[model samples]
Target: MPRKGIALVISAPSGAGKTTLVQRLLREFPQFGYSISCTTRQPRQGEVDGKDYVFLSREEFEQRRAQGYFAEWAEVHGNLYGTPLAPVKDSLQRGQDVLFDIDVQGAAQLKLSLAEAVFIFILPPSMTELERRLRSRALDDEATIERRMANARQEMLESRWYDALVINDDLDTAYDALRSVFVAASLAPFRSPDLPEALLDS
Candidate 1:
């Protein structure tokens, strides 16, 4: 029988290489079920609905939120983003790990509900490198870049709360570090049903 799956949460500030690492992990790890989130933002070029995000309008997002649809939800960068409870619970029930790409605020909320989830924080090597990388993307204006840098710094302060920290100085090296954590988590004894609860209660 397949074992109970774990919740894997990866969080990083914008432009800190969180997306790249998560994308690579999902591509390589077939067992992980992607937790596609619902977002109130307009779709960026090439983004697909129900795949990249659920793509809800603010009204629709709020409507669902009110109906008790979200397991955890938060507003980030002035946009509401939520992960529906149904999909995540379904994956876990099927013995497939659920992967979450979320912000620190959402991470905090998730901890209250899923205390055993594995949390990893991705960080840029330095503020200088992070600024350089953000600018290189050419996706936003200088003012927007500055705001992101500030946000990145704020998020970095919360890295202590995570189980592991991976610095994205070199992509391959960082990816390897990240994969190592997954390997270790997969081996955790808690996943084994043979370990009786009486052992813990004693």
Candidate 2:
């Protein structure tokens, strides 16, 4: 029996190491497919157009958004971001898991839209450590970093409703925890709709 694919949504505040954990998971589990999101923000250095994100002009983004092109979309840090709906549905129907690395806002939207998705939240060791990590990146100015810190507090507050939480205090430990969540979600009976019948037939 072919099992239905799972939608695994991993969300975290900026500098929480969610991106690194997601990358490691994808590398370890090559079968998992990544959902490249569309964004209205300018690409960061070394970020590719389609590979990293479907970078779009604000006008184009609004047009497609109005057409109901996104499964989930949110404004974060003053930028609009969205995940396409079609590819995700196609992959799930084909029994190929899709991984979404989005923020808490996007995750909440996805949950309302796709109730069965497995939602996981990543946390930094502490707010202090989180700020340290963000500053180390040197990507944002003081004001921007301050704004992200404020957002992080709200995100963490919202994270209480997530199905699982992995504290990214240690890289390897966090990866193991995140990987375990995926492994467990894969075994959920709901994802294998034919399991009971197949077992009885066997």
| Clashes found in each candidate (C-alpha, N, C closer than 3 A) | 0, 0
Model 1 worst lDDT window (10 residues): 190-199
Candidate 2, which segments miss by more than 4 Å at Cα? 36-64, 75-80
For model 1 the TM-score comes to 0.80
Pairs in clash, predicted candidate 1: none
Worst 10 residues of 2 by lDDT: 105-114
Model 2 over residues 1-202: C-alpha lDDT tens digits? 7777889999999999988899899899888888888999999999999999999999999999999898898887889889998888888888999888878878888888778788999999999999999999999999999999999999999998899999999899999999998899888888788998889988
Residue by residue across 79-179, what tens digits does model 1's lDDT show? 99888888877787677899888888888878876777889999999999988989999998989999899889888997798999999899999999998
Query: Candidate 2: TM-score?
Result: 0.82
